[model samples]
Target: MHELKISIITVCYNAESTIERCIQSVINQYYSNIEYIIIDGGSSDATTGIIDRYKGQIQRVVSEPDKGMYDAMNKGIAMATGQVVGMLNADDVFTDNSVAGTIAAAFAENGNDILYADLNYLKPNGNVLRKWRSGQYRTGMFNKGWMPPHPTFYCKRSLYDRFGIYSLDFGTAADYELMLRFIHVKKASVFYLARVVVNMNTGGVSNNSYLGRIKVLFLDLKAMYKHDVQLPPIALLYKRLSKIRQFF
Candidate 1:
């Protein structure tokens, strides 16, 4: 079996507390051909120092100012040399050491352009707050508020090379925009892993404040229009309402 190299990117800014866990998760992956990259958005804290301590394990590190999260992610993606690439936020970690191995096997077996799994959101005390289960992909799922967890979304490097990277214009919805562009518009081949792949700490930018949620909604609408998804208004409604299930 040809072991395909997988690059996992972690983007951070002032995330000193949880960055170590993220780094360890990537380092502990069972898959041998893993390249871990970190992109820091000029954090004026101990985040850079913490990352430095793990420099021996990480393949590449970039500490600089960027437009926002999406911009930082674009930088990491650009630097990645792996056949498959994925992102893990500074406040997130892979579910287990086998994640990388499982992903590699899935890619080898299915040869899909993209592979996405489930994810869990945990409180500060490590209690499960929300469980986001991405079942499978369908023709019109995007319109029904179906989106794979961004942290669990892994795609071949060529997909980004062809469909493009995350756009900064969409604000917190950049990931959503990129997924919509690739899956709904470009019609990329995708496979579902049907397993929880990552654990995200609660209180991310999109859900931290009401204002942030509003901004995300506006940007999501813009993304739907930009990608020419039919019935955007209904899709936006479905997107907002679909989150109700995650809490249960």
Candidate 2:
């Protein structure tokens, strides 16, 4: 069987502590056809040095000052030469090498343009904090306050070429806005795999503080309004409670 090449990008800034594990996860993938790119937003720490250690394995490594995370990601998207592109944070990793292969198989089976899977949240000490089960993507799911866990999602390069880059205006919800713009506004076709593909460390910037969650909710509301999409207030209540269930 011909290998399906997937371009995986990781954006980082002062992530020396977790960058190594993330790079290794992609470099050591059993799937040989991968274009791995890492973009460092002028890290003051040892993050660039860590990325250099694996220079031989990476397809492209860009280290420079950028406007923000999304800016760095746009560079990665431009440099990628693979058919499929997946973004994995510096603190997240694929569950195993077969994960990419499995995603490609689904694409081949149905020719869907976008693919997504479930994810788990881990603590700093590598303990499981919660399991984030991102259910299948169906029409009206967004109206029900449903979204694909961004970290575990992958898209064909063509999708980005058509829809464009993430809006730098949205801080944490840039991924959310991009999803809505593509899936809701443009009506892109998608597929969901009911499997955990990635493990992301908790305490990320978006949910590290009470204020952050409040800000996220505000941005989420703004994102929906821009697309003329409305989710019942009760749906947001249910989503919050469902997230709480993951911890137990």
Candidate 3:
């Protein structure tokens, strides 16, 4: 697995409080040969300072203005130079040091183009609120509203080289679009490791408000439509209700 280089990118903007833990999680991984890249969206806070503190550990650090969260992610994707590339938001982190090592071994064992796993959603105070069970990847599941949490998702660089970068058009659902385009539309081989890969803090951009939730459903419908998947509004409704079941 060491032969395959994995590049993990973290996109940050005013994430000073959590960036340190995020960086340390990657740097302290048991698996060697990870290309860690950090893209900062011109943070006015101490984000840059925290990044500089661990500059020696990261392969590359870019602090510049970007369009939005998705745009910053695209910039990092362009800079990635590893066999497989993945993103972990500044506020989120892997479940453990060996998560990356586990992912690498899955790819080496299966030779799949994409890999992902389950994730735990935690509160800002570090309380576990829910477990997002990303059931194994299966073609046509997008119509059923089955998606791997974008943070826990990892894909080969070639997949992006062929399908293009995350589309800024979808806004919060851009990661959803890219995953669908690559895995469902392009039919890329995907492997789902049945384990928790990341621990993401619950209050992210998509769940920040009522309107945000509506926007996610709208864009998700558009993404499904573009690929000829044809998901009805009820599917989104069912998916939402099914997700709520995880909180219990």
Candidate 4:
């Protein structure tokens, strides 16, 4: 069997303090056939210098001005040349060195178009803040406000070519919209690995402020309606309520 090539993209802006951990996690992956790409939003910080330090290890680095995180991710996706593509944010790290290897094995055995696992949110002191357990996916789960963690999501490159990339208009909720479009609308085959794949540090844009959460809520509703989801109000409610369990 031919070895599957996996592309992991990390998108960032002004992430000088935390970028190295993210890079190191990918570099330390046990899987050898991995392509690592970093997309910087023209950060006016030590981020560029930090990225330069790992130039030899990274396959490609694009440092330029982008509209936002989602735009940077789109740029990274376009540059990817691997069969499977996954995104890891600047503040996220793989749980262990075997993440890529485990993902590759699942893809090889299941032949699923999309693969996702669970994740952990860590505090600044490296303590677990929340445990996001994305259970197995089933048909109609999207309507029930179920979504896999974005950092743990790995999809075949062809799925992006078919269903399209993230939408900028959704703001912080673009990832939710893309998942709903692909899993719910396009009916892509998905497999869930019941293990933690990534550990994300606290303080994401979506949950950073009350205003940000409101924007995310409205954008999420828009995404569901745009994708023809039934009873979006109920789904939105369930989505908001679902996060409460992650805290405990």
- Worst-scoring 10-residue span by lDDT in model 3: 230-239
* Local error of candidate 2 at residue 12 (angstroms): 0.4
Regions of model 3 farther than 4 Å from truth: none
For lDDT, candidate 1 versus 4, the one ahead is 4
Candidate 1 has an lDDT of: 0.92
Question: Which candidate, 1 or 2, has the higher TM-score?
Answer: 1
Candidate 4: tens digits of C-alpha lDDT, residues 96-168: 9999999999999999999999999999999998999999898999889989999999999999999999999
What's the lDDT for candidate 4? Answer: 0.94
Ranking by TM-score: 4, 1, 3, 2
lDDT of 3: 0.88
What is the C-alpha lDDT profile of model 1 across 1-248, one tens digit per residue? 66899999999999999999999999988889999999999999999999999899999999999998999999999999999999999999999999999999999999899999999999899999999988889987987767888999999999988989998888899999999999999999999999999999989888889999888899999999988877888989988888889999
Candidate 2 lDDT over residue span 123-240, tens digit each? 8788888998887677877777777889977888999989988888788878988988888778888888999999999888788899999998878778877877765465466556
lDDT for each of the candidates?
Answer: 0.92, 0.86, 0.88, 0.94
In candidate 2, what residue range of length 10 has the lowest lDDT sum? 230-239
- TM-score, cand. 4: 0.98
TM-score of each: 0.98, 0.95, 0.97, 0.98
TM match of model 1 to true structure: 0.98
Maximum-lDDT candidate = 4
